[model samples]
Structures are given as structure tokens and as C-alpha cells.
Target: MSEKKEVKDQFIIAYLPDLDNTQTIINNAICFAKMLNKGLILLYISDKAYKCVSITDAEILLKELSSKITGIGFHSYCAIEGQTKDIINKIPHLLSGVLLVSATEDKTNAKVKEKLASNPDIMLKNLYTSRIAYFISSQNLNSNLPFNKVVMTIDNMRESKEKVLWGSYFGRFANSEVIVYYHNYKDEFYRHQLHYNIKFVMRMFDNFKIKYNLHLSSNSKTFVDYQAIDYAKENNADLIICQTTKNKSWFEELFTLKERKVINNSQQVPVLFVNPREDLFILCE
Candidate 1:
């Protein structure tokens, strides 16, 4: 049998209706679909029985969402499964041919009281393990603006170079300029490390020929993620690209907390998290 490749190029937006940012997610997904020249798939995983009592209700909601948006039409899928299991079992199959754009709720004191932070970590792990090109859209982002300025944040991690390459790919697709942001610890001992990181990132962008600016933040002792976000916002970034760490052990815990901060901040921009190990096979095809 031939490969079922039709869904491969679709852009999946995991929509949660109870969340206030449903429209933002849809709009962001639409913009991304246009930028990537891919189809849009609006997915809602209904965990509550009351939300979608029958398949008919799911279908109706899908149509309602589709009618509100202009330009590209949406392919809708709603799975009546538990949220945890739904993410684990259905996402891999549903996202077989498409990239994922996760519209997650911004973390706030209210959400914390409601205990929503733990779930986002689970979703993050599932997406990372799937090794797909995925992004977490800021709940407050203005998706209407063009992706003319993209910011890629680089740390000392080995995969930082790959993040730059992915950033360049996105930059080219949107016909936008790429800005590489590197946060260097404010210590003289790390000065050489900063230079090394810059050289590596530059080499990755060498062949892409996409206009890019390299910005370094050297004086920082606390709030690393905040500094990165502040820099992106200062430069009027439309999209921010960063790499996702494997969800395991202390590193995963720290990364999840740090990333959650970046995603929920006042800087409302889509943050694309690429798995460094994943090859550029999808892009080449």
C-alpha cells in the first residue's frame, strides 16, 4: 500500500475551547499554514463528556470554527478521549503528515490555582518525543502581524546550531529576517564560551543566505529566560525559535519551568521549539 501522505503537510492546531485563547491559536495556525504553504487542521481533544456528547456535536463545532476564518479551509478532528491518553495515543497518528502548533494557556496565578501547569508539561513531553516541528503559541500574541522578525535563542547546548538552521528555514519561508539571541552568563570565565557559541551559530547560517542579526546578552546573573524574552520584544520579534530538551530527570523539570515562563510572558509571540536531533527530512520534501 502507498503511504498515506496527505496529512503530512497539514498544520495541526490543538485547540482547547475552554481556554480564552482559542481564537489566537486558530489565527496563529492560519498564519503559519499560509507561511508554510500547508493545510490547516483544527483539532480538539474533548475530555469531558458534556463538551461533545456525540460525534455530531464535534462535527458542528468544527464547522463553526471553519466558517469564522477566511482564506484556507480547516480539516477538523475531535477525539473523545482522556486528555493524557489522547495526547499519547492520538497525536502521533493525527500528526503523521503535519507539523503541530500547540495553543496552550498562559500560566498565571489563576491557572495555578486551577492546577493547569502540570498538564502542559505532559503535552510538551509528548510533542518532544514525537520529534515533530512544533511550537507553543503565546496566549497573548497578535497573530495578524506578518512574521517579519524571527528571534532564535541559543544557549550553550550542543543542539543550538540546529536551532539556528531551523530558524533560518522559517525565516526564509516567511521572507523575514532572523535574529539569533544568545545569553551569556556575566562572568569573565564564560567569555570564551560566548565566542564559541557565536561561531557555531554563524556557521549554521552560512549557506542559508537569509538576512540575520546576532544579538548577545552578556550581563545577566538571574532570570535568563526573562532576558531573552525582553530582548525579543525590544527588537519587535514576531516569532521566537528555541530548542526543546528531552523530558527526563532534573533537566526536564528545569527546562519545563523555564520554557513555561517564556511561553506565558507578556511578549505575545509564537515560540517554535524544534527537536535538535530531528533531521530536515520534512523540509527537504
Candidate 2:
């Protein structure tokens, strides 16, 4: 008999800051963890320089939250008292096998600055790691869970394959339908590339026996990310899965990248952002 390979400990990290949307974030995190059949880590990170919640209080809060998981017949760990970057750096496996779920709001206005000072997106960028992240907004608190409908965006870039893989994974695990949106580029070279990507996407989905719908953009001039979000809203999609920018220009850094804009879209749909890396993690059976 062949020896069974041991699966490493894989988990979904839910960043639960001391905010008004704590329960909402927890609920969404639970949904993903359950869907993926992975362990859950309820994480609360406070800067040592500026302590928002005392160590004792943070522990107590985590204890209470962990109880919620247990009640639902799932196990979870509570982590506190470390910087997000340092904790992730310390755990090498976390960089590869973990999925991060956190709440984010539009930080463009003065009103939300104080609340979003410890935003997970900022911490994620600083980690310089390529783990997948799912960002949920307050507007999506009431959205249906188990994500019955998922929207995936594909483009000419090879990185778009990651989005297709993730979408297929979701379809297989959550029994959800994936809606693929691709741009109809007018440029011959780009259009050929787009066709190649779509072919790969179709093949992968068929192999997985996943149900999917395809939509082509009428106007290729519009930004692809925005178009994906618009399609999600029109179709009442429960989630949108797309790739993160591989490189950010100076202007993008200042004005925010396309993925950021999708996360903060006016429609307020939840987004799953997959970093374009060769060694991106895939969920195990």
C-alpha cells in the first residue's frame, strides 16, 4: 500500500479589526472557510506604536468570536498581539497556503480615514507576498452567501489563468455557477491573445465539469475591471474573482490600481483578488 501524503495546515485568515462591521466580516469569513473546508483563524492585529485595543480585551473578544465558530461545528484559532506583516513573515507556510479575508471601504474621503487607518489592503501590500485575498465591503454585508453566482474576468495577459482556476475551484466546491467576462479587443495582436486565453478557460472549465456562462464586452475601450464589476452588478452576482495588478505604475500607486477601484466599486459587490504568481496556492480536496 502506498503511504498517504500529509496535507499541510492550510487556513483562511480573517482580519477582524475593532470596527462596527466585525460580525459581518466574521460571517463572510466563515462562509469561505466552510466552502473551502479549511481551518479558520480569527486574527486581530494592533500596532504596538498605537494600541487601539488592549491585549487583554483583544484576547477576550477573540475568545467570544471563536465560540461562534465552535457553535457551528467548526474549529478556529484566535491570534492577537502581533503586527500583520510580522506574524505572516514568521509563518512561512502562511505566505503560500493561506487565503486572507478582510473588510475594506472607500478611503478616498475624509470621513473614513480615521476608521480605515489600519486597513488590511495596506498591510497586504507591505507583506510583498502573493497570497490570494478576498475584500468585502459594508454594502455586501446583506449579500447572499455560499456565493451562488461568481463573476470572473479574463484578458490578454497570461495571469488571467489564475482567475479561471480560482473560479473553477469555487464552482466545484461551492456548487456555484461561474460567469466569465472577457474583453473583445479591436487590436489584432491583443484580440488573438484574448482568444487564446478564452480557449484555455473553456478547456479548464469543461475538465472540471463546472457550469459557466460567457459574456463578451461590446465596447473594448472601457476598462476591463470596471466592465467585470458592472456585469456582476447587472447579473446580481454574489462574488467577483479577478487578478491583481502585477506591476503598478507611479500614477497607479498614487491614484490607486484597477483592482483597488474594483474593490471600491460603486455597486459594492465583494471581490476575490488573486495575485498573479507562478506558485499561487490551490485548494486541496
Worst 10 residues of 1 by lDDT: 1-10
Report the lDDT tens digits of candidate 2 across residue range 1-285.
011212465666676655445676777877887888876677666656432576677777777777766423344545456665666544335323367776754455466645342453563453335454554554337543767899898899988887786788788998899988877877899888889999998999999999998988887888887988888889888878878888777777556677656766777777888778666666666
Q: How many backbone clashes does candidate 1 have?
A: 2
Per-candidate TM-score against the hidden true structure: 0.76, 0.85
Output the lDDT of residue 281, model 1.
Answer: 27
Residue 154 of candidate 1: its Cα lDDT?
Answer: 69
Candidate 1 runs further than 4 Å off? 1-10, 17-21, 48-56, 73-80, 85-92, 106-130, 185-197, 220-224, 250-256, 276-285
Candidate 2 minimal-lDDT segment of 10 residues? 1-10
- For each candidate, C-alpha RMSD in Å? 4.5, 4.6
Over the stretch 18-38, how does candidate 1's per-residue lDDT look in tens digits? Answer: 433467767777777777766
Model 2 alpha-carbon miss at residue 175, Å: 1.6
